[model samples]
Target: MRSPFDLSFRLKIPLWGSLLIVVTTLAISTSMMVQAYNDVRSDLVSSASSLGGTLAQTLFPAMLHDDVWQATEIIRASLHGGRESNVLRPELVFVLDREQKVFISSQPQTLPLLADIRQRGEEYRRLVDWIATDAGLETRSLELAKFHRIYVATPIVDTGAYLGTLVTVHSKEALLARFYSVAWRGLGIGLVVLAILLPINWFWGRRTAVPMVQLTNSIVDMAQGRASHLLPQNYTHRDELGRLFEAYELMVEFLQDRARLEQGMIRAERLAAIGRLSAGIAHEINNPLGGMLVALNNFRRRNGQDERALATVSMIERGLHQIHEIVNAMLVEAKGKARDFAPQDVEDIHQLLAAETRKCQVTLQIDSNIERPVPLRATLVRQILMNLTLNAIQASDRSGEVRCTIHIAGDQLLLHTENGGKTIPPEVVDHLFEPFVGNRESGHGLGLWIVYQIVTQQKGQISAESRGGVTQFTVNLPLGDPA
Candidate 1:
């Protein structure tokens, strides 16, 4: 069984609203109907008593003269006088003597028996005795055997002597009919009001419920990783729902940004570990490379006369030279050589990245506009250029151009590298120089970090930007006197 509390918010609002309306309407209607019934009853009793008193007064002379026929005539005329009056009609009339004997009556056979009255116990007996006393005008109402009636009795006084009691009996049927009519009208009115309010309640509930439902679904989508780039912008109202949409949008953006930062942090950590490993490997390789170079040099010198041997030696030497350059580039801090940066040095760095450029099927362009060599750390400069060029080559589309421009601007050497590819996203650009912040899957995220560190150490600045499908990195290094 589904719990009652499991209802949707939309349904719950209308359900509870309707329930409240119905309950309140019923309470008010019941109260009003009961009050109307009481008012009618009171008025009926008052009218009966008034009529009974009038009859008693009219029959006083007849009673004083001991004319029973004249008293009976007065009672009969009064009972039949108002055929169209709104007053309660009498069903029975009784003229009781002081001894509780029925002297005259409209329906003599229907007169209540003392045995029957006493059978109802003390309350009924007291009521009957009080009316028989004929002290003054008194009234009593009773319902017995489906017959409801109000009895009014007034004492007939003749020369300060009690002649008899002039009693009138009024039926409650007409009063009951009026009571039912008013009750039904109240019920109908309450029903009409509830009918009117139910739709309005449903409509209002729907308005609130639709947005809530959408928000719930959106939250679920977010949890399941199916959320869109931004939250839906359909809500235009300046209510709480609109504010909630705004808050959700902000939350999504924040979470996405946080995820990117975490990924970058993880990549940076991985690269740091790789860099440590590479440095150790490079240090170990250096000793072996030195011994191989020496052995090859000796072979080349001894095999100078043999053309085939010399050719082979040259190839071996070239391979060793390339390997030595790579290991030295990897161990830049180990070399720690600072010297003037000449055009040839830039050419050498370009040569170092040539294999990578070809592997990526990208064309590399080099431009130098410096008048003379600039004083800089040769090893660090070579490392920076090699890393930047390799990154540009990898970032470029197949057969796209990677442009490298080096020039002297006032007291600074400006180096700019541009690659043709998709524009870098703003989030990546913001942390471009941070370790392990590359957008590429295969990137170690260390090249730019190393470049940034080297440039900052040399009192230079580096900045990256991407626009119109091209990404560029610019480095500004302070020029020093050539040594």
Candidate 2:
């Protein structure tokens, strides 16, 4: 399952943007609804208070003269007046004397239940008492039967003569209906706005998401070595993604240039190593050639079935064979192909380095315990051994022994070379296998570096250490299937 934290930019940006728009829209709509509700309630209370005050003023003259019929007609007219105006119509109107006695009512049938107002609750009693005390017009909300209503009470007075009280009850159903109407209109507008904004948000999101997705895909392709170039047309925008694409192009170009340079350096180093090896091989061959020339000259002097002549010819043949073997080995190493390592390859290296060791007056020792053919490139193995043996011989003191050992451990082949010589300095040992690093003035320093490259290329490791008046090099090659 994909992690929630791994959400792509395409989804994350659009999701959050939509959510923000929705939340803001909802908040605005809700606020409008609340304000509309309060406005409607306020209008209802104001209309009730205005209608009650008007009735109190209209009924004052009739109440002072005790004209119950006139006061009733005035109350009925005021109640019916609301029907023609955009004000909450009163459901009931009651005229009560200062003694809290009902004298006139718009609905005569409710006159008997006016006395039940005192038994209803403290809120109604307080409202009635407040009006009787001439505390100005007052409004209160109460549930009557199944409908909630607002009551507005006003005092009826004639020249400070406390005539009676005028009470008007307005049903809250109309107020609630108006509130709902405004709320639904607001909701409709919000929905329309949301519908229009959603598409725009989606398009905007796609504009950002598509480019980022393309850039991501391109990066993935580059990482997998499937894409070598990016098109400028795809990232033409003046944005961060465009900058990233340009950066990626520059990086790829740099990498390609660096790769080419490294390849050239490696080739140059290999040629340099080959040149050094050729010089050593030429020296080895020159010595044998000198000996062979002497033998040939002696054979010619003792010709015609002489035993010394036969031995001299045999000696010349052996020298020619040795030269041929060394040349063949050099040719093989130059080819640089993976091949099984035979015991003869090891012997060939010893013979190739014989002249160099002899010239240095170093005693070279070969200790071989390899019974099975090693699964490795013969050329690389020979090069590694040759370089180590040469280095050992060069490092050893006069008449000091240089030992080369080959053995198998587990499924790996180990080649080790040690020479009895002055311990190598710590500074030189630190970068011993690096290119152009060597102790000898005549050395170009590419020999051990080439050895290191070959060993690593064959999935092997090479290490060197110097201690106790001896410098040693060890190479471990895995005997596994070729990669």
Query: Which candidate number maximizes TM-score?
Result: 1
CA lDDT, every prediction?
0.75, 0.76
* TM-scores of the models, in the order given: 0.64, 0.56
* lDDT by residue (tens digit), candidate 1, 1-483: 877678877788778877888889889999999899889888877787777778877778886676778877887777686665454777767676666566676664655422244344654455567665546544444444244666666777656677777767666777778888898899899989988988888888777787787788888988997654443566778888889888888888887888868865665566456567767897898889899989988877773368887888789889989877766554436254557778788778777888888899999998888555778766777777888888889989999999999888888888899999999998778667665677888866667878876776677877788999999999999976666
Scored by Cα lDDT, where does model 2 land? 0.76
Q: State candidate 1's TM-score.
A: 0.64
- Candidate 2 residues lying further than 4 Å off, grouped into runs, are 1-6, 81-87, 111-116, 120-147, 158-161, 213-234, 259-271, 290-294, 297-302, 305-483
> Could you tell me how far off, in angstroms, the CA of residue 331 lies in candidate 2 after the best superposition?
11
| CA lDDT, candidate 1, residue 281 | 90
Cα error, residue 217 of model 1, in Å, equals 4.9
